[model samples]
Target: MKADGEALVFYENGERVGTVPLAPLSRVFMRGDVTVSSSLLGKLGERGIGVVVLSGRKAVPTMLLGRPHNDAARRVAQYRLSLDPDFCLRFSRAIVEAKLRAQAAFLGERRESEPRSRYLLTLSLKRLSSSITAVDQQATIASLRGVEGAGAAAYFEGFADLLPERLHFCGRNRRPPRDPVNAVLSLGYTLLHAETVLALYGSGPTPSSASIMRSTSHANRWPVTWSSHCGWRSTSMH
Candidate 1:
């Protein structure tokens, strides 16, 4: 990859593959064996275009943030609030409630078309509603997590009925997804995570320091890795 005036040119085995204009791009994601020129990197940085490099396994992600926000006070405030139990509890509860409601709504929408699965969908919806109530009533994060876990299990249990039989979506399996359905789910989650990290960096908040119903250790790793390479600070709530 190299820059030619205002466009980025791609090369493969010394042969020019194509060229892409930089004006329309917000970010660029590259993977596998690829060579990028210093001039292109400089131009990309100058244009404030982020580049994300995914590992060969396509699971790990490294981000190159362009023109990171220089707000020290906001970072400090986020760090302080992350450590507060009250803040974490309230924030996590609201996030879990919203998640459950969304799950219920999805199931409710599917119920209209799949009459045969209405019973299972209704059961999942009832479980999700109970989980939402539990989230509101629970004072501690641990209890709320339990409620959310139960709701997720119920949701996935009925997931197979919502899909066509040919898809073979037995359950929500990930971390080396066993089936095609799991593979797509894993890929979608990876993309969503990358997008979320970009959004957080663009908004001036540290992704490592933010957690909503996610394990602190697991959630902090991505931002830590990204910040280490991108020259950003890594701080966590836990």
Candidate 2:
């Protein structure tokens, strides 16, 4: 958790209990009640080090989460997750199914049989689908270039506007920490994009891709928060 980058910490009941990787490890395993402060965790994550939070039994990793992500495979996986042509088709079918269920839910009341709700739902679904496709396209076309990194960013514009207003919405109320749908998509794909970016951060001879990665990560922890992908935070710059 220290900037030492040489330290691997584990805590027991808030007490710093031990360390590991006798050598400087590129990875760290935070197990049990091992206590490391969030600052250390953020530093580790910033360095692109992998952090694995374990479950109670130690055998089951209840949270196999990524810190700042360091994989390139996620790019390809995201394309699949981005909802291609098949996704559009399936989404449409889901709308129809939802509408039918909606009608059935109201059958006992013998109401006016309004299709407005269904129509709005379907329309919202289409718009949401379009937004998703746009984000996917952006991710697909993006390269390591400064300008290019954001070429695909536009596809996910105005993401803050889409979320279920009825639910608790993650303790945000009128102004939620983040919209559920947007939060899922942002956290999911950004992790993939960041991993790809991190792997290229300092692994090259020429400054081309690596320099761009450094600049991007420094300017903004895009992998962490795409909202400011161009941020120039000194901490994440490295």
Find the candidate with the highest TM-score and give its number: 1
For every candidate, C-alpha RMSD to the true structure in Å: 6.0, 14.6
- Could you tally the backbone clashes for each prediction? 0, 8
What TM-score would you give candidate 2 relative to the actual structure?
Answer: 0.27
lDDT of 1: 0.72
Candidate 2 C-alpha error for residue 97, in Å: 30
The 10 consecutive residues of candidate 2 with the worst lDDT sum are 204-213
Over 1-238, each residue of candidate 1 has an lDDT whose tens digit, in order, gives 9999999999888999999999998788887877889888888888778888877663666888777678988889988987888887787777777666767777788888789999998888888788878888888877877887898788776677777888888887876787777777666666566766776777678777754534645565554223222211100100
What tens-digit string does per-residue lDDT give for candidate 2 at 1-238? Answer: 4434556665555566667652455555445565556777666655556554443531222222234334556544444533364543343333323332332233212223434334433443444444333432332122223223232222122111223456324322111125454344433333433433434333321112211233354323332222223232211211
Which runs of model 2 end up more than 4 angstroms from their true locations?
A: 2-7, 12-177, 205-238
Residue-level error in angstroms, candidate 2, position 172: 17
- Candidate 1 vs. true structure, TM-score: 0.86
